[model samples]
Every structure is written in C-alpha cells, then in structure tokens.
Target: MTRTVLAIDIGGTKIAAGLVDEAGTVLAEAVVPTPTGDAEQTWQAVADCARQVLGDTSVEAIGACCAGPVDIGAGTVSPINITCWREFPLRARLRELATGATVELAGDGVCMALGEHWLGAGQGSEFMLGMVVSTGVGGGLVLGGRPYPGRTGNAGHIGHVIVEDDGWPCTCGGRGCVETVASGPNMVRWARTQGWQAPDHADAAHLAAAANHGDKIALATFQRGGRAVGMAIAATAVVCDLELAVIGGGVSKAGDLLFDPVREALADHARLSYVDQLRIAPAALAKNAGMIGAAAMALRADI
Candidate 1:
C-alpha cells in the first residue's frame, strides 16, 4: 500500500493543500486565496483546505511548505511580507490539524529545493539551491545531503541578501535586498520608473515579451533584475560552492528574459574558478514542486 502525506503550501497570495503519495504524486489538490491581514483567518483557511482534501483519503503524515523566515527546528515562522504572522507557531497549528499523524514544517523554498533534489532538475546533484522568484524571492538548499536550516531556520533566504548597499528598501527592513529589485512586482515597479506605464504585473510580463520582441525599456528591466540575481548568486556561490542552482515560481515564467542576463551577470562577477562553472537552471517541477518537496522532507527523515 502506498503511503500518503497531506501537504500544504502557504504563500502571500494563496494557500495550496494536497494529498501526496510516497511516490510524489499529488493525489488531490486545492487552492484558496489567503486571508487578508489576519493570521488566524489565514490558518483557518489552510485548515479548511486541508480538511477538504483529506475527506476521501487517509494520510500517514502531514507536511507544510510556507513562506519564511521560519525556525524549522522550532516549527515557527514570521513571514515579513505577511504582517499578521509575526512569529506565528505554524508547527503547533499544523499538529492540531493533523489529528494524530506526524506533521512537519519547512520553509517553502527549502521544500522547493527538496522537491527538485528528489525528482526534478537537482536529482543528481547533492549540493544545490532551490529558488522561487515570485511576488518575492526566496530559496532553500541541501548542503552535505541535509537541509541546512541556518541559525534561525532562515537559511536560503536569498531574497534579503543585499545586492545594492544603497538601493530600495526591502520589507525585511533592509535596503537593496535582492527581492527589492528582482521580484515580479519589483520588476514591474522598476519598469514603471523607466517610463513603461504598465498598470500591473501582467503588464510587466508584456514588457518582458516586448523586450524579447525588442523593446528597450522592458529589456533593461530584465537586465536589472538579472544583474541583481547574478550578484546575489555569485555571492552565494562563493559561500556555498554548490553544484547547481534551480529557480522556479511564477516569475520564472519570464525565462530567457530573466535568466540570460543573470548568466551574463554571474559570468561577469564570478571570479573564482569553481564559481564560474556553477550551473543555474530553471526549476523543472513548476506548480507541484512544493508538494513533492514537502513529502521528500518527510521521506528523507527515514533515510
């Protein structure tokens, strides 16, 4: 009999829950808009989604992939972007929902990386960084075959890594963080400042498409984001010396518009021999990454 795990992914915009099997198959899934400005409301939304998915199946365990900076060992998180969850106890709440089965919590970025390491692009690489570039940028890593949850479970939070010492202020109370210049919304904001009057994020995509089709302003925005990513990745490579970097999330859809420049920037900045050889690739798992990653976290524990 195949074992099933209930997995949940909570983000700034939505909450996704699913029943996943040991084989990494998402048997059933559902999504609901995240609660606005209320942590209890958001937790309730997550529980409701999980209950709905669990109505027809018996899961042996539960795993959650959520926005961080979370204390993985402590099972707590304070997603800076989500104000209502200032130091919320996610692990305890998840346990309450699990009813009896064991449940685990991890940074969504780490889960994404775990998912990739287990079944996607990072399958063969032991040292890798799994990145999600969306409304905000975030990541997780598997170093020495184990998830390295930094001193406070906020490891792999590449988003807040300062790229510009004097750039835009970040939600994390820092200026010139990578996410400030590289996230989807930030890219759109940057484009607007460049005289590209895009009304929202879709316009930013259009701008990228335009750049791909030879629009100068849009091309510049991608270059700016790419440069920030490159600088950040270069810094990480110097520190982690990882074998590969896998990027995912909705904004990754920009594809060449985002990566080509990152590669260029990385090449320009990576002075060390090993750093120069690092491979950065788009994430292969896409939407299912979190569920697979959360499940992988549990399975890896048994090994």
Candidate 2:
C-alpha cells in the first residue's frame, strides 16, 4: 500500500495544506488566508485548510511547517510574524486534527531546506543552506543529507544572523541582521531613500524592473542587499562548511538581477579557499518547497 501524508504550511499571510504521496506527488491541496485577529481563528484557518485538502483521503502521517521559532521537542511555535500565537501548542493541535496519523512539525526554513535537499536545487549536495528572501529573510540547513533542527529547532535561522555591527536595527532587536538589509521591504525602502522613483505600488518586482531598465539607485539597492546576503552566506559557509546555498522567495524571482550581485559579493567576501568554493543557486521547487518538505519530514521513519 502506498503511504500518504498531509502537509501543512502556515505563514503570516496564508495557510496551505496538501495531501502528498510517498513519491512526493501532491494528490490534493487547498489554501486559505491566514486569520490575523485571534490565535484560535488563525489555528482554525489552518485546520480548515487541512480538512479541505484531506477530504475523504486517508493518510498515514501528517507533517507541518510553520514560521519560527518553533520548539520541536515541546511541539510549540512562536512565530514572530504571527502575533496571535505565542508559544502555541501547534504539535498537540495538529495531532488532534490528524487523529490516528503520525504528526511531525518543523520550522518553515528547515522544511524548505529539506524539500530542496530531497528533490530541488540542493539534491546533489551533502550540506546546503536554503534561504527565503521576501518580506522577511529566513533560512534552513541540510547536513549529511538530512534536516538539522539543532537543539531548539532553530539552528538554521540565518535571517537573524548579524552581518553589520552598527547598521539598521532589526525587528528582532538586533543590529544589522540579514533580514534588516536583505528583505524585500528593506531593499525597497533603501532604494526609495536613495531617490529611486518606483512606477506605482512600489515593491521588489517594481524595483527589479527599474534595475533592469538601468536605474542606478535600483541597481545599487540590489547590490547592497546582495552584498549583505553574500556576507551572511560566507559566514555560514565558514561555520557549517556548506557545499551549496539555495535561495528562494519573492525577491529571488528577480533572477540574474539579484543573483549576479550576490555572486560578485560572495567572491569579494569569501577569501578562504573552502568558503570561496561554495555554490549558490535558485530554489527549484519555488513556492511548493515548504509543503513538499513537510511531506518529506512526515515520511521519515524516525519521525
């Protein structure tokens, strides 16, 4: 009999759920807007999406990925973006919803890394970092061909890693965190401050377009953000001896406009021989990586 797992991805803006088979194919899926008001409502939205995706299908296990910082041991989550949930008992709740099926949970960044390591950009690498640079910067690590959640399940949180000692302040109460400089909004803000005139409804896409059109400020913004990301990658590579770094998220869609600078900056910052050899690539699974990774985690026999 083929095994099936219910995969759930919870984010600040939306919640997605899918039923996936052992071969990593999504059999069914559903999505819903994340409720912002109360914690119960937000959880209800996630549960509803799960039910919608499961329907009459039976599954052997359930896997879920949510924003950090998650406590894998306690099965609790305290995502910074989801203010309604403070140390929420996510694992217990998911277990209740999954009933007879086995349930597992991990940080979204870790899930992304697992997905890429299993079937996407990091497939051939033994050690890799998967980063998401959008409204916020997030990351996860795959070591020895498996996800490493660390002691507190927050091991791969590269976003909070400080790159600049006295630069911009971060929401995490840190200075010059990767998120402060490399996130989409922060990049756009820096561009606007530098006198770049965005067409309308200014966003990272618009900024990328302006850069593509040879806008000096827009180009500079990418360079600056890319440098920060590169510095972080170099730092992480030095510490973890990563073979590859896979980048994804909304801003990553800018393609070469973003990657070229990152490559250049990495070359400049990575002076050591081993660190200089680190490779960076775009995520192959795109937006579906998180859900696919969740399924992968659930399918793990040790889980």
Candidate 3:
C-alpha cells in the first residue's frame, strides 16, 4: 500500500497544499492567496485546498506548516503578518477537515530543516539549522539528531532573536530582532532610509543587482543585513552547537551578494573555536522544502 500525507504550508502571502508520498514526491498540489482579516476564512482556505488535493489521491495523514510563533503543544497559531489568525486552533481544524486522518502541525522553519535533513542541504549533518530568508526571517533546528521543538514548540525562532537592543521594531512586539534586520522587506526598508531610492523588497533585489554591477549603496545594504544575520547565527551557534546552517527562500536569491558578507560577519563575531567551526550553506530544498519537511515530520516522529 502507498503511504501518503496531506501537507499544508501557510504563509503571509500564500497557502500551499499537496498530497505527498513517503518518497517526498508531491502527487497533487495547489496554492492560493492567504485570506486576510478573518481567521475562519484563512482556515477555510487551507481546508479547501486540502480537499481539492485529496480528491486526487488517498492520503493517510495530515502535516501542516504555519508561520510563527505557533504553540505546537496547543496546536494553535497566532496572527502571521498577512492574517488575523490569532490563537486559531489549526491542528483541530485540520483534523476536522480531514476527518479520520491523523494531524500534525509545525512552524514553517522547522519544516524547512526537516526537509533539508531528509533530502536537502542537511542530508548528512547531525546538527542542523534550517533557515528561511524571505519576506520574514524564520528557522527551525535539529539538535543531536532530534527535532527539539522546545517546551511550546517555538524553540527555533531565529528571526526573533534580539541581535540589537536598539534595532528596528519587529512585528512580534520586539526591537532589534534578526528579522528586523535580515528579512527582505526589512532590508529594503533599511536601504530606502539610507537613500538607496528603493520602494520595496523587490527594489532591494534591484539594488542588489545594481551592486552586482558596482553600486556602493546596494552593497552596503547587503553588508549590513549580512552582519545582523551573522551576529544572530553566531549567538545561536553557541547555544545549539549547530554543525550546518542551511539558508533558503527568495532573499537568498541574492546569492554570494548575501552569503559573502554573512560569512565575513560570522567569522568576525564568532570568537569561540566551536562556534567558528559551524558551516553555513544554502538551502537545497527550494520551494518544496515545506511540504517535503512536513512529510518528514510524519515519517520521522522520534524527535
């Protein structure tokens, strides 16, 4: 018998669903705009997508990935940037939608790490950090070969780490967080303030392209963003003793323009030999990482 799971990925911009097999193949998939304002609407969006995908295949379980900071213990999710899903009961809702199937929920960051560990950048590493550098910065950790979801299943929230006490305000009601500094939208905002003349995140990418062609201000934006990210990771390395840092998402599209500065900052800030030894690399799972990781979560339940 073919074992399959219904996988859901809910983000600020999109909600993606798929029927995935044990081999991490997406048998059927669909994506829709995430409904804003109404929690019920957002939940219905996900349920509808799942129903559509399930129509194409027989799935045995449901694995969901939502934006942080989710309470995995409670099977709940707070409002992400794009929606009013505050404290919504996601697992139970999905369970209701799927009827007889088992349901599991995790932060999108954790799903990325699980995907990488199963078949992407973290394939051979025992200690891993799966990071997403997109509209928002988020991540999940695998420590000593286990998922380590913390007491509330919010352990690997790398984005919210206070890298600067005097940094910009974060959506999580914090200041100077890694997300404030390193996220694509944040980077673009910072660049615009520096007189780079960009209006949004896409403009930051345009500036990066300009920097690739020799624009100093564009280069400075990436450098500053990289430094903040590197500083945060340097701190994380000490606590998690991570062996590999796998970065993914749209912002990572900046490539060496982003990693080079991050590497330099990490090398400069990571004073400890142990922390210095940690390797940072790009995420290989790409767009499929979330669904694949959710499947991995079902298959590998030990940690």
Residue lDDT tens for model 1, 1-303: 777888999888888998887788888989998888588988899899989898967666888888887887777888876779987999889887666778778888888888988889898887888888888999988888677667776788899889989999989888999999999888888888888865554545676777878878888998999889888888887899887889887778889988998899888988798777889999999988877888876655652
> What is the per-residue lDDT of model 2 for residues 32-137, given as tens digits with 9 covering 90 to 100?
9888899999998998999998888777789999998999999999999899899999999998776688888999999999998888999889899999999899
RMSD of each: 1.5, 1.3, 1.5
Q: Sorted by lDDT, highest first, which candidate order results? A: 2, 1, 3
Error of 1 at 6 (Å): 0.6
Identify the leading candidate in terms of lDDT: 2
**Candidate 3 lDDT tens digits, 83-193:** 588788898888886668788889888888888888898988989888888889988998887676778878888999898899888988989999898888887787778
Candidates 1 and 2: which is better by lDDT?
Answer: 2
* Model 3 lowest lDDT segment of ten: 196-205
Model 1 misses residue 281 by how many Å?
0.9
Tell me the lDDT of candidate 2: 0.90
Score candidate 2 by TM-score against the native.
0.97
Clashes of each: 0, 0, 0
